[model samples]
Target: MKSPAPTTNRRNGSFGHRSTPEHLGYSPTSGHNSSKVSRRNPMAATVMSVIGIFTACFTPPDTNNSKSFVDSEEFKSSSVASEASRSGSHKARGSSRGVSITLHNSIQGEPAIVKFTMEEIFQVTRNFSPSFKIGQGGFGAVYKAKLLNGTVVAVKRAKKSVNEKHLGVEFQSEVQTLSRVEHLNLVKFYGYLEQEDERIIVVEYVPNGTLREHLDCNHGSILDLASRLDIAIDVAHAITYLHMYIDRPLIHRDIKSSNILITEKLRAKVTDFGFSRQAPDIDSGMTHVSTQVKGTAGYLDPEYLRTYQLTEKSDVYSFGVLLVELVTGRRPIEPKFELKERITAKWAMQRFIEGEAISVLDPKLDQTAANSLALEKILELALQCLAPQRQNRPNMKRCAEILWTIRKHYRELSASEFRSFSTSSQRSASTKE
Candidate 1:
């Protein structure tokens, strides 16, 4: 559902809904190295958890107990970023081009955001060639570009329309928020170009596509149950880091499937910070950040929609919708379903309560004993996340822990089932002999 235009006051808590086009191409979200670092740095934990879940559930048993999961090459590469390397080369090029003045706060340890000249931007994109265009959103069109150093990046060019006042605000908001945080599961900020009518944001290119695309089978493969669980946990960790670990808490107003970028390894990286805002400071006795409501239709928190009081829990509410989406493989709103079943979360929860939760599992997934058990537990957590009141929901940190426990149980149950089948096959072979 797209809103027409801005028609309400933003300060008085009135919402003039903003509509972003459905981005079907690769999201310009991911990371490169930066001098700025996260305070409580959870990248190590994220790498360990990701390796553990995928290895135990999907790979053959690792008989070499001496090999720690973290020692694997995949995660080791994730810990070390190439953004710092790529950005340094770009800065030197910018200096030679006489655009060094455009750099924002260049320092010794912390380099400024790479300021790309309009000429360079045009050259990389071939003057905004249609063939290079990947997707479109409310802010602007996205293009895949290859930089001079051969580093692939995503370039987001703001629409030149003079009427859309919110586009500029959204662009700046995304830059400010992305620069402040760094995480394995969050997009990295590379640079920006704001010359005359051009306003562009350059971020790391996430090759795999949006979670929504994969869910819709646009990638020619269905996401298995283990992959879905890993995605949910990855997103939960990202949001939890934003809400708790950052110097100031932040709320990522948009948390839909389209905003989540999947990596080649199938891990999730939360993107689209245009609606992100710092949370209310509890030390000042403030309870919530009263602001204009901005979120997708079905994922918007009911409480925030009604009262216009945004809190950290508002994000929690949206995460709940995401959880439902992950398990059922259904969009938040399915227009073709019956009136009673149009809202996917509501319908799925009703079925869960009615003891028919198994019926709603995505047809693509083969229903097994482990899958069924995980479905019920995941839905139970989703129910809490979708609760009408924000206080009733679990915080993102708790959500991560619960998901971890769920994954552990899922792995154990799968192993037991596998062993049982193996033993049964052995008996049958003996009898035949």
Candidate 2:
């Protein structure tokens, strides 16, 4: 367990409710307790594609620290040349040598992106020193590095875990998706490297680790209610942006807490795009796109699982599970339970329906006196998200608004306590004087 937060921002809300909300009920559902997790019912494995966090082995050259990032004329010329040369090479090279290619997109406001060479990346990463490594996922490991011009960055090297046919496609998907959208809650992409048989992507380095680190791992902070509330709102806003803020919608096939990175101030940044896709145009009469389902377990939309049809609602359904994760702070799959009782969303929903919403909350936030209304609202939202039918779920926009409202209400309650504390402290100081 982590130490408690300092007094200044310590959580404050008087404990337990006068009574549990009248509508809150306790009912249990049967699924995924002792059995395999299914989005709906288990399907033919081939029809429901599944992939885990990807990683593959790579050989990185030792030690090069003299690579300039900001003012490298060589980067511009070399990258452009590499781009020109890359047009014809489709066969897998025995191994890729890192190359920084520059290409001009000169389309009005669109800024050009440059690729970094493997040597240049290695130099910055001190030859991929283990000490500098910050994270690892299905795709690869991430290292923290500083360029010659003194710019700090995160370099993600991909593992060759992808199929030969889809090896380069993942990288392309991320680049295309990230470049096309911009929002405070989304991670910023800097550049990419595909050389020396190593695929790498560079993005702005978020200081704090993932929300998963804070929640399940108990990383740096206690992740109090206020912070969690803020995170919930932040992520909802991000998903809303992805769903409607762009000319063409993008579905972030994965939206688990692990994928949400916390910034220095604990702001949420949604990262990773290996499985994102363009939304089908409804105006064209396509209600849902039938694509292979790709997402982490526990967070995949059940409707998508059963029907093989994907929609924005699938994302909403996943977000519902995320809401439950936020409310309960439990892993989606709990091996501790009999497999059938193991799916956390199902378990949490059972607890919520049983009028134990407060009991199901993280012990860290479980108060004996404060009313459970705040949590009840959140539970209601989570259930709405997890509604069996996709149409029953609220759109991301409404979800964001509701979350923001809940977060604001939570902050208001905290503010009252903060004000009272300040007044009492000032009175004591003056009395001492």
Using TM-score as the measure, the top candidate is: 1
Candidate 1: segments with Cα more than 4 A from true spot: 1-102, 106-111
Q: Write the per-residue lDDT of candidate 2 for residues 1-433, one digit (tens) a residue.
A: 1111211212123211232222313221221121223312332121112111101001111225321111100000000001122222322211132333455343443334456777788788899999988766666687888766565678887767636446466667777676566676777665777665788887767667778778865564578767887888878877877777566677888888778888768778888887787776776677898876567666767667555578988888778878878878887777798854567777666655555667778776756222254666676677667766676677777777677667666666667767887999999999999
What lDDT tens digits, residue by residue, belong to model 1 across residues 315-350? Answer: 987898888899889988888989767778777776
TM-score of 1: 0.76
Candidate 2 local lDDT, residue 367? 62
What RMSD does each model have against the real structure?
16.6, 15.8
